[model samples]
Target: MSGVKRKHVTLSLNEKLAVLQRLDKGESLQQIAKELNVGVTTIKDWRKNRKDIESYTITIDGENALKHRKTLKRAKLELLDNALWMWFCQERRKGTPISGPILKEKAIVLHKKLKAESEFAASEGWIDRWKNRHGVRFVSISGEKLSADNEAAREFCVKFQEIFKENEMLPCQVYNIDETGLNFKMLPTKTLAASNESVTGTKLMKDRITVAPCSNADGTHKLPLFVIGKSKKPRAFKNLNPSSLPVYYRNQKSAWMDCNLFKSWFFDEFVPSVEKNLKEKKLPARAILLLDNAPSHPPEQELVKGDIKALFLPPNVTSLIQPMDQGAIEWLKRRYRRKYISSILEKSEQGFNIFEAMKSLTIKDAIYTIAASWDELKPDTLRKSWRKLWPEVMTETDQTEDQQNNDSQEIVKDLQTLDPNVLASEVEDWITECDKDCDSYEELDDDQILAAVIETDNKETANEDSDCEEDELPTRISHTDAKNAFDIALQYIEQNPTSTPMDILWIKKWRDTAAKSRISCAKQKSITDFFTK
Candidate 1:
């Protein structure tokens, strides 16, 4: 008897990027092909077209392209579409209200201006498709005037419960994801002053990054952290491979989450992680991913896969019932701040100049610390965060408000210890400082939009000049140097009575891994050899 033929899988642009990232990490074509359930030839084709794939993947239109499958087709009237999109962005940035008819008229004008050889009607069908392709939507100008609709939230909860029962979804099969802004380098606003000393405040470091955390209700699986920053290549990452970083890092001019980035993250990270986790737990591949109505989020229709689907929470009620907003994000931030402060204090005690130490903090350091803090978030804390939205998921042993309060108090105490002038109230303010301006989808102002346009135009020139201004690459540690450092640490631990047997064992294990890695690297020929040969 013959076996049934396997169906083919078409990868989206986001998925292609994920595949590229894996290949960059030196995964073999066969290995990736097996994992993705595709043939090696497909992987080879992607590798061959890597440059074109990367070029399209970074453009404004490219980011918001279809998420279901790869679409390399240009608009029937490419020049007209480009001009129309640019005009639309300019008007939107100027806070000018745009209607469908207005857009169509503008498109017609642009078509005429471009003097394209092809005829252009700018019909309603074309407008609708264009909007979908670009991920454009009509939004309220006075968004601030709206308030949370409690009645709607209550109704949605009942509807949500019905869907939950109908789908036969377990707590482990359901997930929630949200994004929060981090002022990664911000310090406390209040500090202690000598009785007779004049106190002056330094400017706040507003350097920002956006972090998106995802986990199932049971907290059995936490997806890799997705981070967005202002720079594509930060100086601190020189000589370091970004693909090897703990978190999945992306970049935008505003360091904010947008439709393109979110869509990419959904397909590239969330779906695969969830599918793998479900398989490991011996559960069905079916699941539901709950999201808020952030403007950046693609519509639910676009998010459906084989057995997984995306569901949106009722508008404006996210603050009340969103799982992450309930306390998960706040707790993560508090944990991150505590870890950051502890690092500074530890180095200061080691006799390093405090100012220099603080100045030395880099995006790379912040990223590793964020990953560590997320890992440290207890499962109980995550499960309890769902109480307001899905009370039945709660257990008798779920963490309580008092326990969380105690954690906050501990962080406050640490802050106070770090700066004698810092008050409990000040620490409290500082902890929530990033939350104030870090909306998941920050609308660009007129000036910001203009600046972004300019930046996009000059991106190639900027990339060319970046190398000349980059910081010196950090020196690589050789295998011998690594062994010596490990040996020194082992010697110190042997002399210290407090050091455990496990500590010595960890050092030796690290040494072995380093040695093995060095051997592996020595056996692989450099890419330069291929071209030279």
Candidate 2:
């Protein structure tokens, strides 16, 4: 039999992109075919279906490539890129040397580990393509070890560069938003504990408030902090001006960031603030809000208005490349802890029990500290954190390990002065302990806790009714403490006749859920009482 004729050669995605680029540059099909060593018929076919080719195109690493999800081969290439990047970062962190030959060996092993097609050749040419795709540059690891995914980091850097280039965005137009859980009962790293004792007797409260902090890449603009708490109108603000607090405060049942609240914050707080800032700066009100794909973030389907664009960081890579994760949130938490430590010392001098004083620490005080801590974060620190993602914005005077060490040492010294018996080595352990008993206040039996809240609301309402002394019928009626919350919700709806369908739906769901919980608690309580009787 005659030898089988060869089928058409397959051009890689990059090559296809190059061919397309050449075609767009007005190159003749014949010239392109000669240059690429492909048939004129093949070139003509690719040119004919240019739109389809363009649809599959995406810029990967740095240059144009086919989107991985388009084909099995592309998907494998993506896996290789990700696995290689992960390995490279891990090795770099371990202070190991990396070279071309070593990288090739690692690539082969990674390919096998990924259970990819064994026959697929991961050759030196492929490695070279990988390097060029990601714009990877080999440099010796220096200074402190850090966790980073090299491919992800490089991708972010390249993508960020492209965004800036395409949008012609100023540093102020680009922003990153992140939320952190701030445990109010958190104590300093040092405390008065017995020498040589393995455990400290004190338990830290795990009661937490979530704060969303946003700042631009250039550090020239910082958005007002958005705070979430359990109470919409906490007793802490009873006698004070809530407006005096620096943060934009809202509340949820869990005191955690939720999608609805995040949306509200985006439209009501973030957009308005950005608009004002733009007006002040005499710049157009356009923004690029970079966010993590956290569950609390609104689903991508939500429409963003005006000239704002929402960009999400790659999954699982936010921790490695997010500016807030780098050090901004950590620094703010440290400052807050330092303030907490100072408060402990002062209250102790005045003969207040340390734990009790902490329990009495109000949301107002926490907000104050949160604002102050944010103020303490240097612009340079914020800019430096973007180094892995946007190196162009990084200042030359990045804080050295020694400088960070000195700052840490100062905190330790201050903590030591406050609690003489506290050991330097144990400071971090103590800080970790501060979040332990955070939910202690909420540990009561479900029914009893609900009853207490209802009772408080009843008393407050009675006083208001007495002051008004109108003959108008009560908008809500609570026959027992069990139904108080539902009644209050009903009252809220009745008072706000303009409630949207969503608001009404939420109220109904909330009331039904609460009613079920109340009934469950009551039945359990009755059974316990019957057994005791």
Task: State the lDDT of candidate 1 residue by residue for 1-533, as single tens digits.
Answer: 76976578888887887787677667787988988899889888988997676555433343345364385656676556655665665454334567777788877776665556778788878987777556665423443334666877788888888998998888999999999988766656443232222333332333568899999998888887899776788777767877889998987666778766887787788888888988998987789999987756655655755568889886668888889998899888888888877787777678764454455677778899999999988788899889888988888888455545665677677666656666777777777774676655666443444444345444321231232133345577887688778888889998999999999999999888877877777666465567689
lDDT of prediction 1: 0.72
Tell me the TM-score of each prediction against the true structure: 0.68, 0.52
**C-alpha lDDT of all candidate models, in order:** 0.72, 0.65
User: Candidate 2's residue-wise lDDT over 224-338, tens digit each?
Assistant: 7888776676656554566777999887655667555777888887888888888899997788888876646643324244566577776557778888878777777666777
TM-score of 1: 0.68
By lDDT, the best candidate is 1
Native-to-model Cα distance after best TM-score fit, residue 144 in candidate 2, in Å:
30
Q: lDDT of candidate 2? A: 0.65
How close to the true structure is residue 242 of candidate 1, measured as C-alpha lDDT?
73
